[model samples]
Target: MAKGIHQEIIGRPHNLLEHYQPIDGVVDEMVDASGNPRPVWKDFIEALEGLGPEKLAQRFARADQYLRDAGVYYR
Candidate 1:
């Protein structure tokens, strides 16, 4: 199944929002193996969820490009 469909299947509208929180001096955070922690999502993606998949994808792509342009990320 597609990713949007998968998120719908899991009923994660709010969880998606929460998953993409913003922070200072950090990229992002997530649980790693052994119940440890790691970082992810250098930008906020949850806000785009309500914009529908196409727009969300466009926004994400744009944000990704911006991050790359700003040298915060590479390719």
Candidate 2:
């Protein structure tokens, strides 16, 4: 079911913002007005995208588990 989805490819990952639609008259912090990712965030975004959704999810899950084990909780 996720095969055709941009973020659900098995071995290949597409641009995370391939379908990003910035609201009109809104200032986006990640991308520029031209829809290209800003230079400052380009590498960071690429690195995360390279991790793919599954790996990113796993990392986040691990982090959450660690936080819970450490007694970290949101106020």
Candidate 3:
């Protein structure tokens, strides 16, 4: 019975790609212009969707902490 990040941020719309719009003649790496997962990313997206937003946020926080502890930086 775990709550998701989406749950934490209640009363807000959860459009993952609200601002995404595919331009003409360009190739999208993950989702299509319609915001549907592309064929190649189907499985990966499904797995992440199963994890829910809270878990994903926690994972991201852990990764960020790890990078900070390890002194990893981007220029």
Q: lDDT of each model, Cα atoms only?
A: 0.47, 0.72, 0.63
What's model 2's overall lDDT? 0.72
**What are the RMSDs of all candidates, in order?**
9.8, 6.0, 6.1
lDDT per residue for candidate 2 within 1-75, as digits (tens), equals 112233343354457787788888999998998889999999998998888777876666666677778988764
lDDT of 3 by residue, 1-75 (tens): 234333443332344444557777898888876778789987876675566666766775666667768998654
1 or 3, greater by lDDT: 3
Candidate 3 stretches greater than 4 Å from native: 1-26
Q: For model 3, give the RMSD to the true fold.
A: 6.1
Worst 10 residues of 1 by lDDT: 1-10
Clashing pairs in 3: 5-54
TM for every model, in the order presented, reads: 0.35, 0.60, 0.57
- Report the C-alpha lDDT of model 1 over 1-75, residue by residue, as the tens digit: 223233342334434445534455564455333333344532344444556655555555666666667978433
lDDT-based ranking = 2, 3, 1
Model 3 score (lDDT):
0.63
